[model samples]
Target: MSEPDPGLSSGAVVAEPETLHAPPPRLSSPLARLALDFCASRPAVAGLAVILVVAVAAIFAPLIVPQNPYDLAQLDIMDGTLPPGSPSYAFGTYWLGTDVQGRDMLSAIVYGLRISLLVGSVSVAFALVIGSAVGLVAAFFGGGLDSLLMRIVDIQLSFPAILVALILLAIFGNGVDKVIIALVIVQWAYYARAVRGSALVERRKEYIDAAVCLGLGTRRVLFGHLLPNCLPPLIVIATVQVAHAVALEATLSFLGVGVPITEPSLGLLIANGFEYMMSGRYWISFFPGVALVVVIVAINLVGDRLRDLLNPRLQR
Candidate 1:
């Protein structure tokens, strides 16, 4: 070997990398930072708190609720439409009052909330997975496939999502699964478009070119390299879509096409109470309506914060 020379000197050492190959900051770091920001914002914090409390209540509905609202054996016609704090409530003491079926309003709301959340979350998750995959494939191999997929998205988007959902539900019939399937059909395009847009941008980056040069297979490049980068806006969209889904479910139920009567969602409750509304037995509809509003508003606030944080263009 020739004289090992770095400026003809032997004592030279390279400085440490810009960042050491330290194991990344704990996964919780970003979440903790997000939590801190969330807490600092009053509306966001309040929204998060509401979501947590509602979720907790929904989880513990069977245990905390005095009676199973769905059990006909537990309901008493005599107790029906009792106002809040009525001493003679047949099913027992109820904090929020009783509906026409003598089902505890609070209990029903909790169960309904559970159903609404379950449907919304599961549908969104399903849509996200499928939509992301389609988006990745379309954008990564952008040619006829991209054109076809985007045109389909365009056609889907041109119609009101609710109308399409209504049509799907008509074919699928009424049930929680049907509702979930309908929402997934209506919502997947949004996720696909968002992912495709993000991936289109990501695929052009130099890292992607380098990844391609490394002979990384399409699957690895699509998921291992590209998917992570496309998730920021997708997460924000998910948060907002959850609220939309809940509202949509309620609307469908209100229109008598969503969840079945035996499992009444918030919308069904509102529909049940519509006649009672004129009769002054307002608690049936009023409390559930309030719950729905609170959930939607809270989720929207949180989603707004997420968008502001994730999208630089949306930042002040």
Candidate 2:
């Protein structure tokens, strides 16, 4: 038995020493907590940093680059094929060299990234909206409607996405809008399939039954309830698909069925430099290719991290 201390005499009030515990970690809001979790992964953090820098550069291309590659007045013919760090007669130094058209590689890449991101993001958003609606309607109705939609999705998915995009582009002709249309056409099926699977699982859950039983409108239950719950996987897919859309667009542009020559994306820039690759002038294609790779890899990294973060089964 523990001996009573002399300081604690009979009839005297004695205070017990409090046990110190680290205060329970304060619960943060979801967004803040998500940010913190994302930051905890080094690769994700690095990828996000790269994406932010590239996005900012692309957004402010005109202000960041020495010259606008699009403006004919800014290009000097004699400056064509200048190596990286070579000084131009009119446009100061060519940091990443020049293409066959005397367009600054750096400027072209920055501008091209802007276009690529715009097309990819817009196409993905469109696909997401279309796909989600289709999936929700299918899952909610089930039976014949679900079978019909799934069959269409299966038929679409059976074909390679790039090949589908190529065919669509060939039919639509070359332009930014056309390329986006092609991409969205090829891409939406994947989202529909994904959303349908998730929605199916969620449809079987108790809350969905409750919502259905409560006489909720189809729009309210599907969009307001089912759609939000299905978003995690859809978000992961969208993030990764942005990279695919950019790559597909680049491929189409490289193949000459993408954006018109008047507007160059990274692929067009690479195609322009293809002839020069044998001539030892590599900066034009090489730099743009590197930029595209960086963008895709960074996006994939972020997507992978998000998948791991959002999927309980994948959590460490």
Among all windows of 10 consecutive residues in model 1, the one with the lowest summed lDDT is 86-95
Best by TM-score: 2
Candidate 1 segments whose C-alpha is farther than 4 A from its true place: 1-28, 88-92
Task: Please provide, for model 2 over 1-316, each residue's C-alpha lDDT reduced to its tens digit, 9 standing for 90 to 100.
Answer: 9998888899889665565555667657987888888999999989999999989998998889888899998988888888999987766788898888888888899999998999999999999999989988999899999999999999999999989988898899999999999998988998999899999999999999999899999899999999999999998999999999999999999999999999969999999888888879878789999999999999999999999988979875
- lDDT against the true structure, each candidate: 0.89, 0.91
Q: Model 1 misses residue 259 by how many Å?
A: 1.2
* Prediction 2 TM-score vs. true: 0.93
lDDT of 1 at 91: 48
lDDT of 1 by residue, 1-316 (tens): 7767566465767667967876767546877877776677899989989999989988888887787889988888878898988764454477788888888888899989998888889999998998899899999999999999999999988999889989988898999999999999899999899999999999999999999999999899999999999999999999999999999999999998898998959999889998989888999999999999999999999999888888868666
Per lDDT, the best of the predicted structures is 2
Q: Clashes per prediction?
A: 0, 0
TM-scores vs. true structure, each candidate? 0.88, 0.93
